[model samples]
Target: MELLKAQNIEKKFVNHLALDDVNVSIPENSIYGLLGPNGAGKTTLIRIINRITAPDKGEILLKGRPLQPEDVNIIGYLPEERGLYKKMKVGEQALYLARLKGLSKRDALKRLKYWFGKFEMEAWWDKKVEELSKGMAQKVQFVTTILHEPELLIFDEPFSGFDPINANMLKQEIIDLKKKGATIIFSTHNMASVEELCDHITLINQSRNILEGHIDDIRKKYKSNIYEISFNGEVEKLEKSLNQYYEIIDKTKVDGHSAVRIKLLHQTNENELLSLIIPAVEIISFKELIPSMNDIFIKVVNEYKN
Candidate 1:
């Protein structure tokens, strides 16, 4: 079931159309990636969903019903621009924000203690936010964002300041949240994170949704029928075995074995290429090369511009 749906969403600001007839469906208990370059209207759409601003056209639905003001209670949003009272003690600010989300003091403290200990943040609770490093402050805000345990969690550029270790920790926590039934909308420029965490995605560009679908399906659709082979054979003999159907794009040595990347042309299949090459050289390993999300992102955006 879809946890959230924005249909025919359109937003305009005085002279600019920020979002144009955009649509997105976020499934329950899944991580949905919101992607696009800067000025692509992704943030505008996220604000609309958060009810920070109203759409000029179209309606948003939460669990098949028209979204309600009360629905904000069930949604947790961590904006791209971090906001925390710099002079306030970490624990104090966290408790305050949790209360704003309707958690009682007793409940808030219990959860805060648990998360602080988990993130090894207990030592910093008494310290002021301004004293913390960017990454540390971000970790504090992250804890507060999910403190209320909302059903829908929206993270915009959630990994902006973290080192590799903290970033990976955040990634694991996000995966755990999904396992425990939280639906997440992750927005970021990191295509690698999208590949690792997103089950589905919506790519917005030029004030429009240019792409939307499962990650694997999108990759498969954009594939060029290229394959990489590794074998301990003479490169000259391997070159002699292929016909016009195969175009060798790259050749290199991997761990003392010769490797070559071949692209199929004119309806050629890997089996046929393997058949021709198997007899010519010893076949050690063969695998198709799929386009990365970063490649697709650039390809689609550029194609749209042209």
Candidate 2:
């Protein structure tokens, strides 16, 4: 089931088209990545979805109906730019935000305590936001965002300030949310995070959705049919056997076994390649090379520019 869907979404500023005919569908209980470089209109689309600004042309559907004001209750958004009153105590601010989200005071305190304890932030609850570090404040914001258990959560640049450990902690929390049937739209420049947490993605560039699909399918779509073969073979014989049928992209020797990353020039099975090479070399391992999201990101963006 799709939790949210956008069709022919178009948004423009006074002189610039921020989003152009954009369409994206987010599946229920899945993590969807919104990826693109700066100025790609990622934030604009997010704002449009949140109803922060009216779209020039298009409509968004939440849970199979046109998005209405009531649908906002089911969405929890953590914007790229974090906002909090610096002078306000962390606990006070959290409670206030939770109440605004429609949580009662007692329930808000209960959830706040649970989240604060999970983050190991009990000691700092009474401290003012101004006294906490950037990462600490972000943690507090995260708690409030999820406290209401919204059906859909949108996080933009959610890991801007955390250290490695806290980042991993947050990553686990996101995965847990998904496991518990909460759909998420994660927007970040961190390709590593996309690979780790995203089940599907939409890549926006130059006010357009340049790419969108399941992560694995997109990776396979851009794969170059490259393979790495590891074997103990005489380097001279290996080169001669390859001899134009295979394009050796890289070669390395490790642990007495030589490995070469080769691309096939024509249709042939790995067994056939093995047949020709086994006469001169002993095979140890063979594996296909799949392109990473980072590689695909650069490749598609570059192709579009050209």
* 210-248 per-residue lDDT for model 2 (tens digits): 999999999999999899989987767987886566888
lDDT of each: 0.95, 0.92
lDDT of 1 by residue, 11-86 (tens): 9999899999999999999899999999999999999999999999999999999999988888999999998999
- What's the distance in Å from true for residue 274, model 1? 1.3
TM-score of each: 0.95, 0.96
**Collision count for each candidate, in order:** 0, 0
**Candidate 2, clashing residue pairs?**
none
**Model 1 alpha-carbon miss at residue 32, Å:** 0.7
How many clashes (backbone atoms < 3 Å, residues ≥3 apart in a chain or on different chains) does model 1 have? Answer: 0
